[model samples]
Target: MPLGDSITGSPGCWRALLWQKLQKAGVNNTHFVGTLPAQGCGFTYDGANEGHGGYLATGIVSNNQLPGWLNQTHPDIVMMHLGTNDVWNNISPDKITTAFSTLIDQMRVSKSTMRILVAQIIPMAPSNCADCGNRVIALNKAIAAWAPTKNTTSSPITVVDCWTGFSATSDTIDGVHPNNSGNTKMANSWYQPLVDNIEALS
Candidate 1:
C-alpha cells in the first residue's frame, strides 16, 4: 500500500515510476494495494494507493480509518508518506509522530509481521504555509528518532528519506505537490527499500 496524502496521490506520478522500476527489476508477483484507484500518471501501472488529499495523520488515527484499509487490502508491506497536511495545519511534530505510532499499531494489529516503510517527507514551500518547511524538517527528525523505537524483529519499520536532496521550489508544481522531477526523485527514494522488503517477503 502506497499510503499518504496528495503527495502520494492527487496525481502522484511517483507511484507509476516506482511500479515501472519494480517491473523492470523483475518483481513480478507484487501488487500495489489500496482503495483509491490511480490518478492520471500518463502511463499504465498498478496505481492502487491510499493517498488521500487534504487528510491529517491525527484525523486518520482518531477516526480509525487505517484498519478498514488494512482489512480490505491485507497488504504484507506498506509504504507510508503521510503527515504533510498535518504540518500544513500547524500540527506539532510530537502529535504527528504519535499519530504515526497509532497508525503503526493499527497496521500490526492487521498483520503482526507487516513490513513498513515510513518516509521522511519531502520538503514543502506552499505559499499559504510559511512555517511548513521548518515543520517538515522537525517532523522528519522526529520520525527518524521515533521509528527505531517501533522497530521489531517481526515487523520492521524502515524510514525512507525523501527530503534530503529534494527541492520544494523546483520539484513541486505548486510548492507542495511534486512535479515530474520531484516524482522521479521520490520514486528513486522508495525503490530500493521497497525492493528489499519485497525480497525479504519472497
Candidate 2:
C-alpha cells in the first residue's frame, strides 16, 4: 500500500515508475493495494494507493480513517510517505510522529507482521509557506529517530531517506509535489528497500 498525501497520489507518477521498476526486476508477485484507484500516470500499473490529496497525517488519525482502509486492502507491506501536509499546516513534529505511531499500530492490528517502509519525506518550499522547508527538515529528523524504536522482527519499520539527493526547487513541480525528475528520484529511493522487503517475504 502506498500511503500518503498527494505525493503518493494525485497523479503520483512515482508509483507508476516504481511499479515499472518492480516489473522490470521480475517482482511480479507483488501488488499495490489501496482503497483508491490509480489517478492517471499516463500508463498502466498498480495505481491503487491511499494518496489522498490535501490530507494531513494528524487528520487521518483523528478521523480514524486508516483502519478501515487497512481492513479493506489488507496489504502485507506498506510504503508510507506522509507528514508533508502536516508540515505544511505547521503541525509540530512530535504530534505528527505520534500520529505515525498510531498508524503503525493500526497496521499491526491488521497484520502483525506487516513490512513497513516509511520515508523521511522530501523537502518542501511552497510559495505560501516559507518555513515549510525547515519544518520538513525537523519532521524528517523526528521520523528518523522514531522509526528504529518501533522496528521489530515481527514488523520492521525501515526509514527510507527520501530527503537527501532530492531538491525541492528542482524535483518538485510546485515545491510541494514532484515533477518528472522528482518522480524518478522518489521511485529510485523506494526501489531497493521495497525489493529487499519483497525478497524477505518470498
Candidate 3:
C-alpha cells in the first residue's frame, strides 16, 4: 500500500513511479492495494492507493479507520509519507508523533508481520507555511529516533529519508507537493528500501 496524502495520489506522483519501477524490475506478484483508488501518471499504471488528500494524522487515527483498511488490504508492506499536513497545520510535535505511533500500533494488530516504511516528508516552500521546514525537520528527527526502537526480530519498521538532496523549490508544485522531478526522486527513495526488503514479501 502506497499510503499518505496527496503526494501519494497525484497523477505521475511518486506512487506511479513506484509502480513503474517495480514492473520494470519484474516484481509481478506484488499488488498495490488500498481502499481508495486514484489515477495518476495516466492510465497505464495501477491507481490503487490509500492516500487521502488534505488529511491529517490525527484525522486518520481518530476515525478508527486504519485498522479496517489494514485488515481489508492485508498488504505485506505499507509505504507511508504522512505528517506534511500535520506540520502545515502546526500541530504539536508530541501530538503528531503520538498519532503516528498509534497508527502503527493499529497496523501491527491487524498484521503483526507487516513491514512499514515511514518517510521523512519532503521539503516545503517556506512561504507556504512559515516554520514548516523547521517543523518537518523536528518531526523527521523524532520519527528517525522513534523507528529503531520499534525494530524487533520480527516486523521491523524502516525509515526512508525523503528529505535529503530534495529541493522544494525545484521539486514541488507549490512547495507542498512534488512536481515531476520531485516525484522521480520520491520514487527512487521508495524503491531502494523496498528492494532491500524484498525477501519479506516472499
Per-residue lDDT value at 65 in model 2? 99
Error of 2 at 85 (Å): 0.8
Per-residue CA lDDT of candidate 1, range 31-136, in tens? 9999999988898899999999998999999999999999999999999999999999999999999999999999999999999999999999999988899999
What TM-score goes with each of the models?
Answer: 0.99, 0.99, 0.94
CA RMSD, predictions in order: 0.6, 0.6, 1.5
* Per-residue lDDT of model 3, residues 32-103, tens digit only: 889887574754777688888888888898887788888888887888999888899998777887898888
lDDT per residue, candidate 2, 22-77, as tens digits? Answer: 99988999999998999788898889999999999999999999999999999999
Q: Candidate 1 vs candidate 3: which has greater lDDT?
A: 1
Model 1 local distance difference test score: 0.95
**C-alpha lDDT values of all predictions:** 0.95, 0.95, 0.83
Alpha carbon lDDT at 136, candidate 2: 95
Question: In terms of lDDT, which candidate is stronger, 2 or 3?
Answer: 2
**What's the residue-level lDDT of 37 in candidate 2?**
93
Ranking by lDDT: 2, 1, 3
What alpha-carbon RMSD in Å does predicted model 2 have with respect to the real structure?
0.6
